[model samples]
Target: MNSKMLQRQLKKLNLNPEEGPVNKKEWQDLIKLIDVTYNEYENHLYRSHNTLNVATDELQRLYTELEAKSSQKIQVLDSKLQNIMSMAPCIIMWLDNQGYIEGCNDYFRQLLNFNESLDNKKITLSDLDLHTLQVRAEEFIKSNLQQTSFTKQIANYYFKMTLNKMVGQNKISILGFDVTEDFNKQNTINQIQAKAVQSSKLAVLGELAAGVAHEINNPLMILTSVAFVVQKHIEQNKFDQLPEKLEKIQSTITRISRIVNGLRTYARDGENDPMMPVNIADVILESLELCVESIRYQNIEITFDNQMTIPAIVSCRDTQISQVILNLISNAKDAVLPLKEKWIKVILRQVEKNVVLEVMDSGSGISLDIREQIFQPFFTTKDVGNGTGLGLSISNEIIKTHYGRLFVDHNHPNTCFTIELPLA
Candidate 1:
């Protein structure tokens, strides 16, 4: 039935081109008239199929050309609308009174992982709701007005679900953003903050330990001095019997003193070191010392190639710089641990009034697509509990403050981070 109707519609369209679009208030009405005329002609399609004179055929041809031009004009308007909808960044979807995804844009399909060849008439939001998305949609549609819009966690991240009712059509359209990265980042930040507080508490305990160590050092020194004096007197032949005991006491005191001092020395750095002319080489060495345990634990061998003279330095915050180095080395260690060959290199070079500290490792390098976005705050490739994405961003910010630059080096083998600091 529709085929016969289609043939008549084509015939009418073929003839109508000879006639032009009648000027009117709006072009839509004229276009509709042309379509309705075709539909009517389709009713009598078989009766007059291919039965026309040369003059009638000529008239039909003229009408067909005019109609084709008119149709083209109408299509241009539709194309404009489609272009707008399809190119939109926001997912735009439409549904009838029945909560189905009747029409959707390219962005909308991508958001839902909908097929590229998805058609407007065939699919619905409910159809594509593989992960209980349909259930959420149903809940939204069931409600008259959902002011308290909430979030949905799918896979490892969160997405905000919003629904808006089409006022006239009694349909609903939803707009959504994949808040997975943002949500995960926020949670990590919270965890980091909590960890920092805990670390501060531990640091305070370390400070107390330092005080205890300081207190013990004085008595330890006095005992050692007295024991040494007694040992010397005994050895001079006045008290041979007591000399052996005196020597042992002095040895015990010295041992205790060493333990006390070591406790203070290994604390989490006193405070952020004041800005100074810090030797870049010295910082690198100290950072190596700081990360030695971690590096060994990960079994990642490190080679430090310092091409910079110890005299080559930069004026910057020493502790922050140290933290930056620590973070970078830690990142490299973590990255290289999974690889078959565990090797990390800390290469420092003095080039053109600047010092560059490069941490290169035989590790899984970053993907090319995401390489540019790696420096963004709260960006990470590590799993949930492994890393707090802030390391590179914080390092970048610290370097920037000192007129330095920190960036990933992709041209080299494996993963690399290069920090360049201006000497002056």
Candidate 2:
């Protein structure tokens, strides 16, 4: 007898239960074939289920390994970031929207002289001892600027600070680099350069001493003649000519006063002078007053060509600029004094947004080999005792400080040094 489930399946397959099999042999063969098919189907189903379970287990194992690796990589990156922040040579700080200290790196803490960690400390900008930084930070916060930079002095150290506002966040970051050494070094260099410039001025004065003496002597002779004439008039009781003679005397004295004043102004230290907008033409004229007499005494014809229709106004230290002009004029005089045709011409003009001043002499242009080195400190073509070689170098430096350019105009027909300064 077959099982009840198999008998029902066989009945459904059109084998009637009430009527037995027509052929007993064929009926048994059909039962055997059905049993074989059912077994194959059950084995296939079990293999598919087992494969699915194994695949699920593999997927879980891969996911766990990926997570572990990701976690380890994150830890490594975090450690590196921490080390970089701690070892950096600059001050780094973060602040909340309300200007309260949020966090800072080790350098920042050390800069502020903090003895304890600021992890949970509640501190405001004003609560710190940095008054200037606090004030500037407040100003920056109040401004619409997203970032700004400035220099501040704290105790004995100087710092160039940069402040930035984080985008899409109510936070500010402050970065600072210690610049005390650089600042002090620059100041010392400026001082030395100032002295060198002053010394150069004095040297020029020494060269002009003879011409200055002659210049003053002429006016002195006129004064003396006028005084003698006035004395004669007083003795003769002729008061009418006295007024005219007195006017002449006054004019002569004024000329002498101007020469002396020019010398005094040129000899002073102008290193710390504030920059002001001045007419370049006026600077040239004033600079000429100090050396014009000297040039004329050497029979060197000097002329000024002011081509600008308007004032060539430039922002600069006029005194320092005067020194540059004087240095150039002195150089021009030396260059042409030995030549038969001696002449110096100063041309002032405006080019685009710049004021250009050219000091040209009646001589062949400088050779290319030496032109490149003319602006180097302690490089000169003059006799050993005749030149300090710092004039051109100092002049170039001064022009640079004024945000201008000084160079040799090799294209010109004559030897010329050009100064190009931005218009004020």
Candidate 3:
């Protein structure tokens, strides 16, 4: 969806924004959207810089190129500003400290609605003030110089005025920038850094969980085996009086074992790299087998569509890919809560040179606004303490390590998350 449409939808949802911090948050949300849509621009910034802070010739060249682009944008804005001057509905002016019209853009001239060009090129801030009514014009002028930046109602339009001390001289350069498009083109890269930090913490937690699971699995296995034997003895009429209790014990042990194992792998960092020309179909089947028991327990139907006859271009760590797939599948299952429609589709296809594996749920589709932020670590849509929000982010990183792609699709009624790998 376009920004305007999204904004209108937000308004309809009564997400009517307030000023100050609330407004900042709204802009931050928009900034995330911009990042997703403008990933290539960011990648350019990265590939052009010395990320390690080591100044290199390539970095310098990239920096120069970026500088050139910024200047180019500025020049375009400058020309557009002139055209807008006459067209603006407000009284706009570029004034000197001595209260003379240093210049006026088109918006200023156009507002007069007069083709008769005023020969007055020497109009100043004071002249505009007289036309603006001086009941508080003196205070406005004084405050304008004092504040360095502000917005005020002038001629029924919002005028955001800013003052800068022209370098090399002690004169103020006052100008107005149209907040129309917001021009919030600031490239805030800290999101990725924040994500990396969150992922690292989650990795640490996963590692601890893995160790605990491994340590307890053996004991749990032994206990579960003994419990089954006892349950069998009860079934054989050896302990018919305690049959119910034995069954309960057996069931509890199995549940705990599964939960423990779940925690262990959740924290893994793909410690081993074992790869071969493995059949991706086999991997998909194994992933399903790993989750089928849980899905069956919840009465959820599973669909596996593997139409990809083409082989993958690269061999990746199977366990790692499985972990990523399992994470996505788990999320899909959890999303279809309380709904009668309990179907999940796992589709694998070869699109050109890439292998695409998609897990689509029958739940409500994801919102476009949060879709980009979904892969951001620690930025979960789940309730507080319910999710660490690192699953997709870490999964994305894992895919990146393997030189693949990960994304969520909201183009359909069901939400689809896809992972693409290069064909080997």
- Model 2: lDDT of residue 331: 93
Local accuracy of candidate 1 as per-residue lDDT tens digits, 188-268: 987775465335334333323434454456557767777777867867976855766676676767655544443333344
Candidate 3 regions exceeding 4 Å error are: 1-268, 271-276, 310-313
Candidate 3 Cα deviation (angstroms), residue 228: 14
lDDT of 3: 0.64
Tens-digit per-residue lDDT, 235-281, candidate 3:
79787546665666666666566555544444454535565556676
Highest TM-score among the candidates is held by which one?
Answer: 2
Every candidate's lDDT: 0.68, 0.86, 0.64
Off by over 4 Å in 1: 1-274
The alpha-carbon deviation from the true structure for residue 160 of candidate 2, after best TM-score superposition, in angstroms, is: 4.0
10 residues in a row with least lDDT, candidate 2: 1-10
Query: Alpha carbon lDDT of residue 73, candidate 3?
Result: 96
Q: Ranking by TM-score, best first?
A: 2, 1, 3
Q: Return the top candidate by lDDT.
A: 2
Candidate with more favorable, higher TM-score: 1 or 2? 2
Clashes of each: 11, 0, 21
TM-score of each: 0.40, 0.74, 0.39
